[model samples]
Target: MKKYIKPYYYYYYYYYFYMAEKIGIRTATIVIKDNRLLLVNSKYSDGDYYLFPGGGLESNETIEEGAIRETLEETGVEIKIEKLIHINEFIYSNDWNKRSLTIFFLAKPISIRKNNLTDDGGKIKQVEWVDISKLDEIDIRPRILADILMKAKGDFDTISLNHSVDYKHES
Candidate 1:
């Protein structure tokens, strides 16, 4: 049963949606524990992809606050964000135009509140603790995340950030 929505509400909804499409800011956390990293596995019609535990920054929250909040929401674990790893701007579009500057952070989980993955409204299917060495076997996005993690304990302090990767086409 479809409920009735007023004309003004529809205008508000579309306006908000348009603004969200214009500027999308996201965050990703690198949580390493017991020689393993936490990851979320997502299955879609095109293929499967793994995401680090993180999400969009809220309107009134700082990047660190959003990182901690999103981590808990997606993984059911409380986290303490330690340091920023990198800030990269990714420009890509599918149906709707989407350009997001993703802030990657190094964080530690304070406690595991739940053993299973929490509801991401069906976006994520499962959560797993993957061994650091086995990241080669899975499909992780940004393509540089795993490498960035591997260098964390070494000279991560010297890594250059704000590198832009353009996936936009020549259309």
Candidate 2:
């Protein structure tokens, strides 16, 4: 007679959740402090909007690595990842289907150099540090990116993603 082995039923559920968590939308944001926060003005289908100096994470790269690489590539500034401030989930279905899970981190600028890299085959129009005090003057992506920075207190803090949406139709 052969020995019989039974598998635990909970294992399947656990694995499913783990995989979902791993692949559940991913993005990164880097905050480089000068007198202001480092922001990138990039072309969007709907005119232009501002965002931090980070983007989607490439395969095999950790979030920190991605943040550093993206920031360097976008702004030509090497940055040290300080702490994660917030994790946001963005969902929008309009002109195009889009969904993202973003990781926002507080970073310190290590060096400043000119960036020759460009996105979408065009030169990056502008890379500038805006005063943190003037955050309201710019159109920031996810909006909460700025809010968390203003609210961060001590080191290594985490916050749930909270964003309010208003309906606006663009032609």
Candidate 3:
């Protein structure tokens, strides 16, 4: 007998309750300080990966509020959201049911917690500040995001990804 394994997204989509029409709204915070970007190393079923500090939005919180909250929870750092940088539509062309929209915000840290880390459903391994220039060397979710951020020149651009980034701006 062959053992069957479900994809990571399947477990996520099936377990979480979306507030609106099965469309999930996620917020990510991009905090850079001293030429370093804040990122969380997390473990998934497939493997470990790095992502910005963020998570799904709650019912009562505004987008900015949610972003701030999620960032603090995941990174143990208090942040002030500066502005919206990227809006990503991560919808699967083949699976409409597994659709999510992610809003990325540029943020600045206000306070830092020493040795304090919040549990992202027990998935987060550690939070670290990675040098901005070295972002390409790691595995980041929504892979194209690393490329876009690496080349971004203060101009905000929206990215729509069915399976890849569609908008590319060269500075």
Each model's lDDT comes to: 0.74, 0.65, 0.76
Candidate 1 C-alpha lDDT tens digits along 54-156: 8888789998999888888888778888888777666665535666777888888899987644576687887789888888788876557677666554345
Write one digit per residue (lDDT tens) for candidate 3, span 1-171: 223355656666666755334666889988989878899888877778898888888999999999998888778899998888777776555544555788888899999974566655788888899987898899887667777778874445564342432332110
Candidate numbers, best lDDT first, in rank order: 3, 1, 2
TM-score of 1: 0.75
Candidate 2 per-residue lDDT over residues 25-114, each given as its tens digit: 354555645557788876665667777777777889898898888888888888888777777755444413344566777788888877
Candidate 1 has an lDDT of: 0.74
**Backbone clashes in each candidate structure, one number apiece?**
0, 0, 0
- Locate the minimum summed-lDDT window of 10 residues in model 3: 162-171
Which lDDT value does model 1 have at 45? 60
Residue pairs with clashing backbones, model 3: none
Off by over 4 Å in 1: 1-21, 93-98, 115-118, 151-155, 159-171
